[model samples]
Target: MRKINKYILILAAGVCFTGCTKFDDDINTNPNKPAKVSGTQLIANSEMYLPGIANNAYGSLYPQYLANTTYIDDARYTTVNFNFYSLYYGPLMNLESVINSKTLDGNEGPVENQVAVAKILKAYFFWHLTDRWGDLPYSQALKGSENLNPAYDKQEQIYDNLFLLLDEANATLTNSTGAIKNDIVYGGASLSWKKFANTIHMLMALRLSKVNENKAKTEFNKALNAGIIDNNAANFVYKHLAEETNENYWYTSYTRQGRNWYALSKPLVDLMQGTADPRLATYADKNAKGNYVGLAYGLSDAVKVEEYSLLGSNLRKQTSPVYLVTYAQALFAKAEAAKAGWIPGGDAAAETNYKQAIEASVRQWNNNDVTGLDNFLTQPEVAYTAAEGTRKIATQRWVHLFLNGYESWSEWRRTGFPVLAPAPNNNNKQIPRREGYPTQERLNNTNNYNQAVSSFPYGGSDNLDARVWWDNPNK
Candidate 1:
């Protein structure tokens, strides 16, 4: 009877242990898991993207119109410079790792906020890529560890995919369920991300209006209907801190001796001078003589010394914000679209919006002053004239995009605005439509690069004036 009791007791103990193990397993099976992040950290890791993108776009290329040292000085310059290539590949490559890994890992339950941000950033980067290069690797380009050599996709296809991604991002940004943590641009505000997504769509549509009018109009209407960014408050800018490590792109470039090479060009200075644009004072500092000084592009060594002008690295200041997109730019794009009849609006309304865009841009300069803005608005050149055609609209857009050289250059290529002069010694004598594949790409993906180049119109040479597919025609 005692032996029988001992066996029963042992069985009871085993049953209790099994029950405890099952309870612990049930507790551990949580549906909501913390997101795995590696690439999104790259954006917040340092002040890299903000300054890096700003420096290349505003600091180097757009000022090509002004002709300065830090960039190519030959009358006709071709070939991808280091700065240009770096901006093109650096951010994309980093973001790609995060995106490709997440998709391939296939561990989806609840959506990761960082993954959504990565998608949005990826879309933004691709927008730049398409605007610059026309056709490039899109769907397969950023496969992380999977598929090392991704094939290139046409620009049209890329745009289609981009639109899809933006839609998904908009849907995924529902933060009511869970919040996005490290959003440096919008502070994890899902509403702001939605606005950013819509605004970017508008810009993208405007860019494609020349090539695909119907598609552009449709996208524009969608963005407008969805409600785009209304004012400067909604501008998508990455704020820079005064700290040396956190200094703006301009400050970093100008303060560093070897890197402190660029300056404002004569064309840019002349434009401000002619318009009496107040922002000039803030954009550039006066020399000892109180004159707005800048270097002329394509100048000889002796001329540069005599000029007493430096390249425009003023954008490198710690105060300078890295503007991913601006309310002013969006307004200007809308005005252009309206004038082009890409949307339902008249010239008067478009001109009003154009002037407003200019005002917004000037007001946004350094100080948010409305003083002198009215007088500046009334300038005969800026006022509405049907004969002005798209030139007027595009030129004003160019002015607003002044500090942002890459966008300015892209717009100029698209619309032939601001009537830039061809480089006197231009090898191809054409403005560069797109940067060539990076040296690494050439070395690593030689076959793919060669195949892509073969499809280019000018034998794949990085000619300054080679027009991309979207550029309407050579002026």
Candidate 2:
């Protein structure tokens, strides 16, 4: 029931600490950045970072949804060590501040509600970071003035703690107190927060199916039993505004800056166009020739941008919604879990959820219009078959997650469905399994960084090919 005040958000950004790896060791040394900020301000600042992460250029490129028209280095997988300091210092640190704050004024709802929201958000941010780069400084990293150089926690360990954090948040949630302010996502609605936390838990649990099936089953069912995003209205979406300060990322890039660096990747366009996918029109625009033509995925040579389709207006418009977690995601996760026997009813349940998942995805992407959905589902490749259920669910889920590159990339690594090939001229020769640790880690946290790289389960190498704990190719 509350709206974000841009001026307050601007003020929050100005006063908060800007850097962390060592939890911004400079904060204590500098007089300008505040040592402490309000719980409300901290949460607001953390929420502000979600849109940028959701529309991450690197994230989209990794899954081959978008292709580079000019700078092809990222498409070619040239960068090895992608830094995550922005995440840690930005949302992660801000959420941690809210979680640790002893003083709460109830401006953003009840004190307990604030802490619960903070805990869920903290878990979510860490989940995002660990998925990107395994073995992060979880338990030890947030202590300011106490531990400057914290050791990295293994990905498995981080996941375990993340599950617990979500559980704690879900347990503490109470009815919404209408006084909640500066809360952009759900207007501080406690039920919506509960569903979101549980939804996150369910998805994270499914991520472990390849590595630890028993734990995955237990956790997946636990979260499902608790609750999740059951309807489109309850989806975790970041609503972008028309204002320059808070406009959609694509709008800012294409409309304001007039930089059209990316086009729909050939693989994505071909698959969608071939399938008569209803969402394609909403996902991409017709090229100069007035047909939907995708650009080549990782071409080394310069190419004409006009030959390929650009991102759709629905996506690039200033007020376009950026979906983070959605009912479709929950349904697809359910479809996967049903096929895996994590939940009862087996193929029957899997088929039901799979059908609903596709419907939900079509509706969500096409602005709640299911005009051509029935015929689309009856297609041989799209239809749910028990023998081919996992592949079907995985592929559809990947499609549903368009523009959400990091999540899709993680799923592609785990499932190996709708098999994506290495970029033709990729520097690694294979698709990157994980991003290398930031180069700064080698200098600032030398010993710990070395320890993490050495203890890495898959090959013990700090290269892009090293798989994260849950991304077990053997499974």
Candidate 3:
């Protein structure tokens, strides 16, 4: 696809918009930046910002898969700014711009496909935002020349709209023709996009298992019938380039500093060792003694980091693929759904789906030892127990989503599986349920921000201790 820098494009929009005037005949004047761009260019630009949302440090730290060794602020929940607002000005705006441009002038490709993709992406970003901050400016967000302090929409409302957007994307994709230009995610293939939309809807449905069971079952059945990602080939993944500006975020962070700043966490290492998980080698490197050791998370002061295993080479490489949603996640979601009686299948189907999730995870990491995989599936503790089947799926999902912090932490909150311990040195005396809103929003949009914080069902404060709308704490 195209390689336009999203941030640069956003920053230089006014410069690009300046029309050619009296000096139109000058040859020395550069004409590289077009006065206006197509929906294709905007779609391509939006893909480049995925790393900002996916490869950041909060999700990994919250899930206890990776920890900051030198400075424990993030692990202990001291870091206030997770840069939540950058999402609205950056990727979200870019995507909405695509929708606006396409709608106004028609589309270079099929208008339906262009608008559908834009809507799907818009919903995707909104989902990411609302999950992090609870309620947000969803209904009125991305209005370029409209209201400044857009009112925040409730989390339930956002989810409803997201489901509708995904359904619309599915229909438009099936009915339209012409490849989506600059579509880096699925190479312009409409079928892949359709599967992605449906599977994403399936994932969101699973999130509602604790809060809204009836709605969850309804959406789950619809998404399942519509089809979802079922194999490695159809997984929603993206690989960063090897260039200086385009390298993977983890790779860039490590290369600029040292790799020892962050190390594998003790909880994750213990879990892997307890289960004899072969994926440990795939997640972390061996220490000086050639054994996989992990560092304790949330230490107050700087300490020796070389004593523990660093991140694995496969993940640290500039070319590593960042998995957003995967077949493994889909299987585990189904397993849990079946176990909860949301679907027609019973315990047997849950068992099958659970086993498939484990196998798919193993193979996804390139671990192809048949004997090891078979043993892993059949182990007494690893095997699916009738009473503990849901927990089994939840724990495996946490394992498979190793570096994906937000999703891993979300599942743990929803299912209460794996029983992750709270960080020892956290100032709050407990693990944080949701991050605080950005400081900028509090300053600039004080009234709106305060309104959202007050309307929060659990409490009217935007503290880390407050749970999001769907956070079924007792689960």
Question: Evaluated with lDDT, which candidate comes out highest?
Answer: 2
| Overall local distance difference test of candidate 3 | 0.79
- Writing each residue's lDDT as its tens digit, candidate 3 over 1-475 gives 2244322233233333456565554454455544445676677677777766668788888888887878678788876545566778877887788667724324446766777787777777888887888888887888866878888888999999999988878888743566766677876678788888888899898889878889998998899899899898898887677667767888877875555678899988877877878788889998878988888888888767667888887887876888888899999988888888887678998999999988898888864554477767766768898888877788889999988888888878777877877787675556667878888788877899889988896773677778888996665
Candidate order (TM-score)? 2, 3, 1
CA lDDT of each candidate?
0.64, 0.86, 0.79
User: 84-142 in candidate 1: lDDT tens per residue?
Assistant: 34543566766655555654222222245555666778788778766766667777765
Q: lDDT for model 2, on a 0 to 1 scale?
A: 0.86
Instruction: Please report the TM-score between candidate 2 and the true structure.
Output: 0.93
Worst 10 residues of 3 by lDDT: 6-15
lDDT for 340 in candidate 3 is 84
Q: Which one wins by lDDT: 2 or 3? A: 2
For model 2, how does the per-residue alpha-carbon lDDT over 276-311 read when each residue is reduced to its tens digit? Answer: 899999999998989999988889986798988999
Backbone clashes, each candidate: 21, 0, 1
